[model samples]
Target chain A: MSDEKITPLIMPKWGLSMKEGKLSDWLIEEGTNIAVGDEIMEVETDKIANVVEAADPGLLRRRVATAGETYPVRALLGVLASEDISDADVDAFIEAFEMPVIEDDDDAEAAPLYEFAETSVGRLRYAVRGNEGPVVLLIHGFGGDLDNWLFNIDALATSAKVYALDLPGHGQSTKQLAGADLSGLATAVLAFMDTVGVESAHLVGHSVGGGVAATMAFDAPDRVLSLSLISSAGLGREINSQYIDGFVNSVSRRELKPVLINLFADSKLVSRSLIDDLLKYKRIDGVQGALESLSAALFADGEQKTILTEKISSLDVKTLVVWGAVDEIIPASHAQSLENADVQVIQGAGHMVQMEQASQVNDLIKEHIAG
Target chain B: MARTLSFKDAVNEAIDQEMTRDPTVIMMGEDIVGGTGSPGEADAWGGVLGVTKGLYAKHGDRLMDTPLSESAYIGAAIGAATCGLRPIAELMFLDFLGVCFDQMYNQAAKFRYMFGGKAETPVTIRAMVGGGFRAAAQHSQMLTPIITHVPGLKVVCPSNAYDAKGLLIQSIRDNDPVIFCEHKNLYAHEVDVPEESYAIPFGEANIAREGTDATIVAYGLMVHRATEAAENLAKDGIDCEVIDLRTLSPIDMDTVYESVESTGRLICVDEANPRCSIASDVTASVTQEIFSSLKAAPQLVTAPHTPVPFSPVLEDLYIPSAEQVADAVRKTMAT
Candidate 1:
């Protein structure tokens, strides 16, 4: 209750499972003034390493946690205060700091983070976050889960209500696909919206999901507020047939390693964990059949079906088409087909532009949605 | 997003996912599909504790409910492995391994070696090990040492759900016979497990806690106890690194050796009885390999040489507590 402002810079929770993080190094020194969003430290979690940005603006009074040490989430890493605070007061603040007691059992049961909704298609699994705003639905591509939007969901959630879903044939969702084509898949999306009570939502789609989103817009124009397609499938006819064949057939890490390299401009981004994750998805009971059905219906003989370029140009919805310039799955040249849509060809990115350049893509998405 | 999954669900998911991936994979156990011959539901009881519950719905007849004979089904599972089918036979309780030891050790375990590497037995025998539920002597022994002593068998006892899932996947995929032990007490212990399938390689020990003063090596339920002890030790400024030896046969002694060499102190905690247990085995190896680096005699914290008591109070005393581990660490520091 003092006149001087105090801020406790706690350890950030990057992902859902990140319980603690190793504070590798501090970017700023003590007594230095810092602004919000400034990179203050480098924190490494078990999954990935990233910089921790300051969420509060103040004078860096004291460093509470040492570098080269790991601290649990909500544990005070540093103390930020106004310059009017004395050294004794800063010491007292540091001494009195207590970690936010996380009653995990209660926290977990209080709000269901990941939920399942029984749709007409199947029992579809989805993750709903954010309270109130313009609702945005994130649809993953072929063989991907709600996790494909891991980097984007939290970022977009700051300004709008975000929902990322696993379609009928993928993730933890039921593997039964009633119709193999885009029309059937679009109906599943509509069914999910109806079940979740999302009357209308701005749609963000990647790869095959992009095709579904476009079809969804075409089928029900009034329901979709806008459309953002990332490396979408329906925009072009030319596809890497070898990649599709390799993905479907490759079982071991050795065979899949080369196949995954095709998705990223930087081959190093195809991490062992990434390949392992995909292999796990591939191993699930109905994943193979679903992939086969989707592949046959959408990309037959390495050629694209359900091209919506002409239809999208005539449509009234606000559209933004984003593609990785070096995308090997679907060529970046396909981004040009959207006649009146704002198109972006991100450089040095492959099929996973959203994940490759997350911050930039997030900024673009935020701007597009707000506009 | 990763979901909080129970150890039982994780094991079930691993088997279910593996069976889906490989056509040759099959599951067999007594009451695994409870009402196998009865007129009631097909997947009635799914094993004693329902570890294989709901798997029958997706995999259908692949999840077989065998007769009450362990030796017969266990032998058949071993024989099926020599052919092409990858069979996952649940021993019900590891205490029942006595009935089928010949099939596991002599046949499945030795087939590859005796045949000059011509034979491959890719079989996984999953059994519930360790005691906590007042299951008494017959149901409660941690016989990891017996399985680990055999040359051809791969032994794995996971502490948490995530490891349970990954290690089970690796065991199923491996060409050698694997004795995958799941602790009954940790069945309900939850952890963030990925929905997607993944495999954790064998022989790599997971660092449960990292510290500088001492190294505590443990597996299964003892890992949790070691972690608790490490926390209490930290308060007394005695930082202890707790390592989980996920696999017993191909134990990652290198990680343990590195940590012990750095700290010059070692403490081994095992739920198994003191004599010929994992604790004594690890202590002997580390001491023999790196004798000069030792600042003190390696301490072993394990249950006494007696049957797991049925009484609640005696059972509480049967398992090695965090207090005992912390005291052992203090003794090492004093030495």
Candidate 2:
């Protein structure tokens, strides 16, 4: 027989935390042509559901995994190669495929890499990924934290130092507000910047985080090289008071799911686990008071209170404000409210445009940082 | 005249006072401050109910307003608790708990026990509970039992502003995760609340009224209902003892057992719905421990096994009344 070849299509790991995933559906038949990045199948993790793109371009020789089956990380799902690839070769390749187990051991290596540093403001917990580049401080809006950029941070950090943080009252940082206004948040961000030893870098903020970024840039133009605002809060008067009220007032799953759904253009992005996560946070003590103070400070009567139109206009730092066209938390029209800012209203995303349309936001952030 | 504040204001004062007293104590929640970057004002409603009003001015960013995301913030509060920041996260409404219960049960509640007592989740989750605001079904639920069942978490449902302030302060300082249930209906209900910060320890039942014939145990707003029933019961020449199980999770079983031993009759008045409720839990525990001492079978005055109704009439009939509590007490007394 002529030389035979085989390719291993192992179960892929999409994120740092994913250990196992369920094969949601198979797009290709048992034997079919597949290419790299091809829509081969769908996979569902506990957190999200996404298409599993093909790793190697070739004919899908065998389907070892079936729909609705659960597999550990790196488990061989199938084989892929040219038509000349023999089944015997595929079987041998499968046998050689190393199924790496996600060690259930709780002895976390390297101290979990996440730590909280206490400062004058509150406990600012941050996660720094990648060794080197211009640091990108990811600030989430009103009730958000470092994890809101779960999809974008790692992708953005490939070329730049990515720092995802929990604001004063937002995440593992501290629930206490140093001040309820943008300056309070801005100061905390600066203190966090100082604690982390980043002299100057990019400020990437979403929603209310947009306001914090603007404050940082306005506070010290020398320190902030670039500003990336995604569905920010500072440039407009119209705000979704109902969503804010619903978010603040909601305590049950039924109440929070709807409010959270209002955050994304794709309401389906708000999953059960997502709602469960929010409930877990809200149930913690002091969070209610901190959120109430923030809401009253940032948005009252469901309208934006801190308008920094002129403050951000004259800044020499490269400014990029991205908004989802369907953004509801802070209207997409607010993107136009900035006169001198480079505003891009992404067509499909909502308030969390960075998450919904991450590639564009990441590209915009990268390009703005380069400038 | 009794010096009083709205339930919202009283809660705000409790937080402000506690934060003032203890620098380690901190507050976090969504939109506790009204205006962030808008044109008009700052500290705009002081929360949806305006409970956290003026805290931003007093404590600065220490009174934080988070993004509308509860998981990140609440988990952060629990996280901060382990790191020495006594975080009090406002859940807004108890109904919204579905969004962040994991932080409460799996994380905060389990942290101390899971870590083998090395950690203390000194976190207080303040959430508006019960129905009366026309908040409909989702916004209105007295699901205290759901939290009370979880060990390692201290649950407090104060009936009045006095207990609200004191118990909230206690929740802040307590070295455990506490789910503080705030009855939206009782926020405006006034009572004399001391300005000084003091903590009422958990597992200590407050004897609202002392009597001889029957013992009525209740909590949250139902304490008032029990008091009112005790008043009517007094008129009927049937003196009743009322005990508020101040801390439901650490529940003063000793007080219940003692009362049962003294009176030989028990009636549990709970605002929560019947079915595996605190009432049922208390009834079952009481019967098991104090069955020999009981002269009569225990009675439970609670909401029906159904969702909190929206109609005024249905809601009015939904919650256990003072009359019903007294009647339950009277029945136990007769038996």
Candidate 3:
């Protein structure tokens, strides 16, 4: 992987709709040791403010991508090279680096991110990734969808199959939820897995999805190989009343943005695009009432109505729990409540611990799956 | 399961079955679930006349009982359709659309073309239409022609329970926003509705009764009246073809033209007022497309250009009757 003496720093793609971004700032100067995965520069898209990390290692060389200058995705931003490589070599590499014709949107028109499979539960919408190893199903919390795993899917897909599904009444899946609750959601997930022919899968969940995953593990231990709960709801009694209330009541962007911001450590990540994305989801025909009644049913009294933490010990599955220190929605203290599970506390993260510090959380997930 | 269901029950079964069949489908309306906050029964009244009964209990919150605010909820449902949910929001009665029609005409109907094909508002706004129950102008009045004028919105006014069930289910599942006008008087009418969910696409007209002399085009409750007129004409020597224009927006003019071309005559029967009614629209379309095919001037059988009267006798005469339809068909046959 390190054969390239001249490293190409390309414009990074964040969320689904991002077409281009501005080279906002350069965090490092030339001649610095540009290690792999180091924060090389600061790129800004309309969606969020995130530090662009290096994908390869070399010495920082020519800075073709200037500060505050905008470029389309994969446009050559800068270059890095070894100390032994001469400046002439860097110039040749920069001149030769033609922006590769990145096949993105046009290519995707024929194949979409959303797919509907005729399941026993009806046509369910789900996103699948990876091709090898035991499948891992990433079930989002209340009012969440497959897009919630946009940050985690690429990292986890390297070792195993990763599936992000929209439970009935959520995402592109059908909204006709006649029998809706934790069990109903679990039934849909199990039916989807069976339809997709997954004998066993590691269940990775957030919030309410955590309850569904736990229920599945308790009900059918044979089908679940492992469990990863991030800011899960099943372990504790207390639930944030404001998050629940805001999610149910808020309909407009002005009303919903603050509520969505509560999920992250850095509220700035709650960009207009993020708010717009969530509002788009909430505006979907049946989502509001679905989330409302589901909240009342699952979190009836501002507390975890179904405490299945005790059931986790009975199931013979490798379980890992993680939490964000600054989490406002679900208390980080719940991370220690898993009696026989490995626990990690991510600093400066909120209820959405995985997204706030994706690299660290992804490392922990990979380690658990590798073990 | 396949028992003869009332028209109200047929509508419920359509929504219920479609919701069960497609997870993207959802329903919303005021009092569609009667008791939201009241201490009475949970689903006190499944719609004003009980068309949506038993769905709330089975579907839970997916069957939403909106606030008296139709504009906000209708707009929200329209907005939601663009995101992903195929929402079916009941407007209670056709009269209530006045409080919340801007969302239908400006937002839901125009989202796709306005967004340059980036959006799709697959919403279904269902409301009880047509006059007959002594429920005066406000509660009655077949307003199908009004919605039919819009380009993006698909307007469907089914005459009988079978068409009602299939067309309604299709409306809920269709990828375009739809306006479903149900005749209030037909609620008690009975028909055998299939348990399985299916769709009846727009632009397809149903031949209620076939004849060779003249073609009578109609919709909603009036389709039944047209058939009754055709039956009476059958008793006589006249053979009349009754064409039910189930969907108004994508008007099945081809069916009308084909029948008109064969019969060489046309008589349109509509419950709406005579001025700019479905009858008038059909006549205009026919004249423009197949003026040469016509043997005689098209006769429109519809109520006079006036509001629905309060008196039972006046109201009875106000609706296009079987005798009037027969007379209109006779006029076309004579020429």
Instruction: Give the winner by DockQ.
Output: 1
The whole-model lDDT of each prediction reads 0.87, 0.80, 0.81
User: Compared with the true structure, what per-residue lDDT tens digits does model 1 show for residues B1-335?
Assistant: 36799999999999988988899999888988865565587777888899998989888988788788999999999898889999999998999999999999989889999999999999999999998889999999999999999999999999999889989998999999999999999999998797767777788777777788999999999999999999988877899999899999899898899889999999999999999999999999999999888899999999989999999899999999999999999999998
Q: A197-300, model 3: which lDDT tens digit per residue?
A: 88789899988888889888887788888999888888988888888889888855546778888888888778765665565456445667778778888888
The ten-residue window of minimal lDDT in model 3 chain A covers A102-111
Lowest summed-lDDT stretch of 10 residues in model 2 chain A?
A105-114
Badly placed stretches (over 4 Å) of model 2 are A1-16, A27-40, A51-63, A78-80, A105-113, A336-347, A367-371, B1-335
Model 3 CA lDDT for position B19: 78
- Candidate 2: residue B231 lDDT (0-100): 80
DockQ metric for all predictions: 0.14, 0.02, 0.02
Q: Candidate 2 lDDT, tens digit per residue, B148-222?
A: 888888899887776677678878888988899999988888765544454555666666776788999898888
Of the pair 1 and 2, which is ahead by lDDT?
Answer: 1
Instruction: After the best TM-score superposition of candidate 1, give how far the Cα of residue A248 lies from its true spot, in angstroms.
Output: 6.3
**Candidate 2: what lDDT?**
0.80
Determine which window of 10 residues in candidate 3 chain B has minimal summed lDDT: B192-201
Worst 10 residues of 1 chain B by lDDT: B34-43
What lDDT score is found at residue B214 in candidate 2?
A: 90
- Could you give the fnat of all candidates in order? 0.13, 0.00, 0.00
Error of 3 at A330 (Å): 0.3
